[model samples]
Target: MTQNIRVVVVGGGYAGVMAANRLTQRDDVAVTLINPRPDFVHRIRLHQLVGGTGDAVVGYRDILADRVALVVDTASRIDTTGRTVALANGAAVGYDYLIYAVGSGSADPSVPGAAEYAHTMASLEEAQRLRSVLDTTPTTAMVTVVGAGATGIEVAAELAAEGRAVTLVCGKVLHPYLHPRTRRRFAKRLAKLGVSIIDGPDARVTGVSRDAVRLADGRELPSTVTIWTAGFSVPDLAARSGLTTDAAGRLLTDETLTSIDDDRIVAAGDSAAPSNLPLRMSCQAANPLGAHAADTVLARITGGQPTTIAIGFFGQCVSLGHGAATVQLASKNDIAKAFAVGGFLGAKIKRDSFPGLIEHLAHEAHQPGSYTWKFRDDTRRQRLQTLAER
Candidate 1:
């Protein structure tokens, strides 16, 4: 009888859960998923949760494969040389293969007192906490959202629509990913919904206080609620494990999604920086990368060839205040085109995309032997060659 291959997946997010579900389908593999939380936090819905519009929690048992063992614990350390993972509870797990999907955290502003005074909408807990604060606050309470990225824009727009005094402070122009026309349309929509757009010369947030936010120009805006949605930084787990990482501490992986220094270790989601095609931290990359990582592992175990993970750029979607939105069509490089939609039509598309993504992930998880995509050594070699030439 063939020995059972032990595969351990850390983090129960989209990438980890999808990889665990895929790996468990193989009878020869025993999969163990480790996470600190029992339920998976749908991070994309965090903005909605903050706006008190939706529930951000989903039970993992409802989604994960029955064959996969769920271990509720934080992965404290990874001993790659010994093929063991130490948990926070003083238990160590041995694995023939390991998948690190430890995702990222909110990029806190470097400004003084912002860390203490500002609330971020990065996680479910933070969103819920922000909601609680909003519920008790007066309707005329001033709220300032720092950053104008997707998360910042969405939260600010949603809160503004609820009749709060909201101001969006963007270090740069709003909707930088959208075309100029689309950006102008969104700016008008936000203004119409009572959201003040502070950008360019008046954009930078210098400090946060209990009752106001200080700007770089020595101006202070009265704010009872302050939200920070600046950006994302990868978790320290990759660097802590002594794995090769990028400047931001994301694990550097080969084309096959395997760690460059250790073939037995693989990385996916926000924490992974692929050699040839590094992508931004989004569900678009995490879901596909998870599937690809599982396929790479199966190829190695099944004596099949590994396949190159392909990343294609999908268009951008942004929720305008209330029942309005903007969608921008983009090329493979994420360059925006003149094609754009706004108002109710764009909002429908934006709302529909969330469920559509979940359905696609569910469908991919149900496919049989989906883990065994052929690997291309030539692709890896060419990527290395390109890097050398650069």
Candidate 2:
């Protein structure tokens, strides 16, 4: 009888869960997933949760494979030498191979008073807490949303559509990821919905207070509730455990997604910086990365050469209130193209994309190595060349 390979996947987010499900295809492998939450947090819809239009959660039973065991506990330290992972609850799990996919959260030590006074919708718990605060805040009170990214825009538009006073303060640029024409379209729609957009020098936030947000230009905006969606930072489990990592604490991996320090350890999602060329932090990329990471591990176990990453990206989709959205098209390499879709049709596309993501994960669970994506031929060749040089 062949000895079974034991694989322990950390973090239950999209990347971790997808890798676990994909690994279940091999009968000779035993898969275990460790996550702090019992239910999967639809992180992409977290803005909607804060906006009160979505629940932002789904039970793991809906997507996880039956063969994969789920453990509801936080990972504390990783002992690569011993091939063991210690949980926050004082439990240790051993693994022949490990997948590190702890996703990102609101960057810590954020602007002063931001953590103490401002609200964030990065995680399920944070969104729930912010929703509670929003329910109690007066409708006429000023709500300042700092950041002009998709998260901030969605939150401001949702609240403004509901007749709440909203102001979006863009630090320097607004919708840096979108083309100028698309940005203008979004600006017009937001303005029509009564969301005031503050950009340029006067828009830079210097500090956050209980009742207002101070600007770098000595201007202050009165705010009853402040929402911060500025940036994201990954957990430090890899760095704390003495694994090779980037400045942001994301694990460092080669082109095959295997850790530089140990071949038995692999990484995926926002927590992985492969070849120091990390993919954009989005669910669109996370799913593919997870699948690819699992393939690398399986290849190693079977004495086969691991495949290098050749991932491409689609555009960004942002929800602007209930019946409006913007789907910015992207080039094969993921540069925002000038063309975009907005209005009700765009909203429909956005809604369909959400359910499509979950279904894709389920399909992978049922048929491993079945979820495949496309990339331009030239882009694929270029990526392969880059990996060869590495």
Using all chains and alpha carbons, the TM-scores for the candidates as numbered come to: 0.92, 0.96
Per-residue CA lDDT of candidate 2, range 186-258, in tens?
9999999999999996778889999999998999899999999888899999999999999888999998899
Candidate topping lDDT: 2
Question: For all the candidates, what are their Cα RMSDs to the real structure?
Answer: 3.1, 2.0
Distance from true location, Cα of 378 in model 1, Å: 15
Decoy 1 TM-score against native: 0.92
Query: Which one is best on TM-score?
Result: 2
lDDT per residue as tens, model 1, 291-327: 8888888888888877767655556788876667788
Model 2 Cα RMSD, 1 decimal: 2.0
Worst 10 residues of 2 by lDDT: 375-384
